[model samples]
Target: MAHIETPTDEEDITDPVEAKKVLRKVDWRIIPLLQFLYMLTFLDRVNIGNARLWNLERDLKMSGYDYNVVVLIFYVPYIILELPSNYFFNRIEPRKFMGVIVMGWGLTVTFSGFSTSFGGLLVGRIFIGIFEAGMFPGCMYLISGWYRRHELVTRMAFFFVANDIAGTISGLLGAGLGSLDGARGYSGWRWIFFIEGAVTCIAAVLAWFYVPPFPENSNFLTPAEKKWLLNRLKSDNKGMSHEKMTIRKVADSLKDWKVLTSGVLYLAVCTTAYAISVFQPTILRTFGWDDLKSNLLSAPPRLASGIVSVLIGIWSDRIQRRGVFCLGGFSLSMLGLFLIAFLKGSLRYMGIYFAAIGIYIVQPLCIAWCANQVTSSAKRGTITAFAGTLGQFGGIISALVFPSKDGPQYLPGIMTCVAFQIAGVIAAINLWVCLSYENRQREAGKRDHLRELSQEEQDQLGEKHPDFRYTV
Candidate 1:
């Protein structure tokens, strides 16, 4: 056996076989754990809604306003802490940082089972919001460190499908847990938190080993493989990896136009996604079904969403156009909302499938799209975190929009979502125009250059490198 020399940018290996081999290893060792953790994370977050169907509000004597308030409180810390949490993840040990946060949230959910009053549930939700805030942005930052810009949307789709899968199964799990209402002197809803929370804790323990840190710090990769991986990424993105967090880098990320516009786009889409996540069960119940039946039927739309997200991701990757799909996906979402809003009977019910597809599928693309614009490792963390933080504002709007008075048709909420979906479409168009103009500028600058910079210099310049192009 011979050691392969560390590749320079000019000599970077882009062999399909080698790329596939490494990707497969990463998929096997990394993606599954992240997916599972996210599944649990999502399951914990939404199961409270299911618990409401099982008399959660009644059990605690929670007024409609109180219930909404409790739900709203969670997003407070979720919005405030996201950027700082992600920064901590970037600076700290991934396994420990991620594992502790996972465990912390799981414990929070577990204690939620014991809540005897509205105040208790509020306490549980607040802490759950605090710890779970880090999960998506942190995991995303980690995934970006591994894949090239073109490859990111698919990987993000793979990872985000967990939310859809969790949505699909969380209903079934809730229904099944409902059967345990009297089990061991605990209510079924209580059992849901206890059992799901415990599973999350177990996943956290496994994550400590399975969720390897940055590739450079991984124990699994050989020196040759690390060199090849880093160089290939460097060739695709000059500042893809090998950077530490610093104050100047953080400030630069905040000042970037791409970061501001991308965050706005993400916030728009997230408003739609968060609304769907919380209200789907209640919305499905309007189809004249019982609780169990509503839970069961809700599964199909999410399953469709999971399937559509992956397929759309593959298509987006192949086309190498993120903003186009974002625009298309959000446009589809608006149509779905219109169908659900104005149509009657089965047609409106059918709209769930379209709505689910539109909302869930666009999520991965939004995250990947913002991430692709920032090439520096530290800036990636800051921008992704900032975008995620802003998106939490959508969650706040989602909570308030679906007031209890708007039962069955819920026209106001539906219309509000339609409006936001339209906003999301507009945001997508803006992102496309911005990226297109910037990429043209970069291309033009390259043509006017007097001399080519060395690979090292280009790598140091990152997304600002004259040869680097943004993924639109």
Candidate 2:
């Protein structure tokens, strides 16, 4: 495999104006396409929640616990395939690999509408899980490759905003399509699957043309701009090394304490996020709103959360701090969970907005934070995928927590989410303290003995190099 070589002759882009201009150009070309792809991915994944609102369970003859079983089935392959899919993603051309997976899931989603029984739906979800597994982590890895550490959280936040957009659109689309329940003799929920899936298929086709390759292979930038971008990223990690995917690197990533801790944080956040995406409409319906109103009302919280995410991304980047922001976000989420679990009427509804904002805020930040601490491409990709795989367990937990028997105010489910949020807070604090201690040790020259190693050995050390400081 080829590596991105930094040009020896090229100087850094010293002018702030030119730097901003180059970054803006890159952002416009890539961010929108990435956002669109992720939006579709999310839309297809969670629209099942909206589908339930339109008599999908009744029409398919699903009985007690059957609906949750279908939801749980999607996460099985999704979690299992994440590591290998991302491994191939690291090895393959970005455009080809991403396009194929998007198309695969899109077709699966479309055909999913044809299911006549719970077993059929279950099968379709498994395939969807397999295909969709690579997307979010792959995108995070790709974004990390493009931007420097300080610029990363904001870009990732913008990318993650796609989730909020998809959630909002899913709600609106569910209501609009639900109105077409009898059109062409197909149920409205079926139309949701058919139409959204078809759009994703089309987007997948466009991805082949529009998706930017990794920086080394990208043709859209000038030679100078590309060199500057690559060099900028190189400087961000000082002793960082580029390496091909290898089994050892994968094992190293799995063994890293930082990776394990980050995965635990992500798992906590994902548990809350998956629960909300899959059950928000149902929870809202329990608030005395009819199906249409439940779907419609779901949109606002997502929109509000999207705005908050972008703002926090900018602030987090400005301060160049991740852990503190994450702690604050977790606090907000816990507050929201408390209100929803214990309060009544509109106050409980207000909890949705709080939970949405905090969860969305923490999620992208956590990914960015993890990526920030890793300096090797291979290790970074593996770490991202491994953490994401652990996070998907949250989807399984979500499926089990909100049984149909626990409606109106699913106290048990809401409280479970609250517990996860508190766990996230503790994890964040532990990671922050540990990294801060490590950084202080490096400053005190405790790691100076490793500086005697050869340059090649030092480079291979990646984040463990004496000069390579951990981001707190």
Candidate 3:
């Protein structure tokens, strides 16, 4: 394949595909800061789980399904605002938008620690929802803006590791902090909220200072390095040039069946993922361990999930295939669910925790895959947000299953999660098979349109060749 060099503004670039490749290059200097920013995002979002293990509800006198209700409140404004949040991310400056989100959520996380009543906690969680809601999709939008579709899976896994790894940290911290339940007149669960929430505010301060804007607007990159970046993207075909998307454009981008399928696939994974995220520590409590031990035990499964995520990401990239990883990983996650569902308390089933690792794989890979599937870069960003937001609808449903009264044994919730993981696997297979068949047909020289037609006859083909991808 012939590559096109990045053209200067002074020149007219030929081969739009080659020009597009020039736009996908990443700035290495900024990635580490972004990773930490995402780390903070995950930490603040999942710390509520740690609070659960620390006996937060019991301390506050939350009963019945009240705990679940508190957790569910965060997702309300979160899901409702995602589309506009992402649109704001792209339209406004990401560095500014993202920093504000980080700082705002940090405040909410801190206030959550001081809530003395259900109404107060409800208010805190709602603030958390409003603040943290835009941070993720905004950050993801920033990431895809910086890197090309192909280079993103492993990187997204690294970024998402922040979530699982944050889970581990929350577990470890929750355990240690619960040991301080009676210290300084503060309950251990309250301290967990106080400490973690405060840390997020501090991290938000750091994000304000460190998280840079899009590369084209970056100060760190030399003029020459920026040129190198542009040229490199011109070598990949996914456009990253200066272009903005309009509302009508976003709607038009949804015309493909692939968009609908990708949304469903991700929703399935989110159902299981969110189910486990908020409830994992509580689930471990059923093993007859007390608050501290249960919180500590929650760390291992998350660490296991993080470790396997990196390996699966590398393997998925190495194999140069996205769909295989999505299907295989979800299958393993489902298997883990089955083991936990049936074996209950057996040593033979201990590996169920390790199998949870597979669930982590689909998130990063499938996210990267779907973002790559669309042709228009602006359209791609909106689709990514749409898929993520739609997927979060699972959170609403998953939260309803883990009742506080079901304590010491939440089998119904775990089984519910298992069913969703299987559903994701099936959806992934549907997408994989569809894309594979499309590729084969193109290889066989079947144009779908009449081959005998003149170039002008197939107007809708626009510049898109069959090489266009689908998210597995």
Candidate 4:
């Protein structure tokens, strides 16, 4: 068992100065390393869309549906492996597990560069999805372990900014790599894979040594610091127990209605996010811009979204609220997508900026919102994976909606995103209602049965414990 040292007083344990010091250390040590890893993951996943502008489909003799099929295949392995990988992530030391995942995906991405036919590229994408299955969910689980619920959104935002940066830089990188066209007899698209994958591979090797595990086992902290950190989190919720995860626990965690609702909410958002990330470059090219100019134009919208994500995260944490921010973000996405679906020319270009801002900001908030509601470590892992696994189907939805048949307008795809954005808003409101009602019930002493249970039993009950109040 890990050592647990109790401070003589709660005030000493939560001293503002000491808490700030630890927060800064964790932000610097933990967040930066994970940020780099997630950025690489996003780069490899969405760069296929970037490849399209450079004649990747024509070079490989791929039909329009064939391209969609290739994109679709990635989600198969990604969804199937997410839950099991997260389960194992908690069982194994995170450094080894996450390192192996990063390296596996990096290798697969590099191999994708060597594909001579559509079949080879298909196989590479499948493996890339499998290897990447655990990264985002695992990162969420890991971040939850370090920070309290109120402090979580900002940290998650910092981590999520990597996704926006990846989207923005994919454009810049795709443009620069275009210069490498015909070098070593490979197209610019191939060099995008080769160079980015090589860098990911190097970063993965370093992550094994750098990425810290749960706070209790972290090597960078002193023994007293580790105990203090653990105690501080435990006081926030008793369900953060050291007990080993079990099959029953995993099943029970999945049975929560909130998990399903959260999954649906995220599913609605993911379609919009993946669509924007994967196809925004192609969308820009339709405006009479050449390959380089389209890629350059793609950067600003995502850059705006990234900057706003940090600000929203800080605001969410400051006010200790999440659902309203999510609702507002999705509303922005709805307006943006509606504009894109109906408008043309310069006005439509303005829609892209609005859509970009709305699409990217909601995702991190949703993840952080879900993370705050769960109490147990194992349950947190399970729900994050469950939500992620369900949300990944949105990628498939995106692939199917935007066939090349739609061309420059892509009205069906754009409207599909608009409809989902409305659904996401509704789901956010519903979650807020249910959570608030539950908190009221707890305040009214409706969970008196919790008083009869021992500490271990109360811990096992997780969010069901009477003292546990859901974050709205």
Best by lDDT: 2
What lDDT is obtained when candidate 2 is compared to the true structure? Answer: 0.89
Please tell me which model should have the higher lDDT, number 2 or number 4.
Answer: 2
Estimated TM-score per prediction? 0.93, 0.96, 0.88, 0.95
Clashes of each: 0, 0, 9, 0
> Could you give candidate 1's per-residue lDDT for residues 46-138 as a string of tens digits?
887778778788789988688778778998999889888877888888888878989999999998999999999999999999999998888
The positional error of residue 302 in candidate 1, measured at the CA in angstroms, is 0.5
Error of 4 at 36 (Å): 0.7
In candidate 4, what are the lDDT values of residues 57-112, reduced to their tens digit?
77788885988988889999999999888788888888899899999999999879
Provide the lDDT at 205 for model 2.
88
Most accurate candidate by TM-score = 2
Model 3 agreement with the true structure over 1-472: per-residue lDDT tens digits: 7755655545554556744444433434455667777777777767777877666777789888788788788888888887678767777777677778888888787777788888899898888888877877776777776665566787788878887878788778877876788899878878877777777777776777667676677665556556555555544543333457677766876776666766777787887777777777777777777777777777778788887887777777666689888888887787777676556665413645744677787888877777766645566667677777877787877789878666645668767877777777777788788777776776676755554556564333422444343344
- Arranged by lDDT with the best first, the candidates are 2, 4, 1, 3
Clashing pairs in 3: 21-233, 21-234, 21-235, 21-236, 21-237, 22-233, 22-234, 23-233, 181-188
Model 2 stretches astray by more than 4 angstroms: 1-14
Identify the runs in model 4 with alpha carbons over 4 angstroms from their true place.
1-15, 454-456
lDDT string for model 2 (1-113, tens) is: 45434333355566666777878989998888999999998999999999999879988999999999999999999999998887898888888998999999999999999
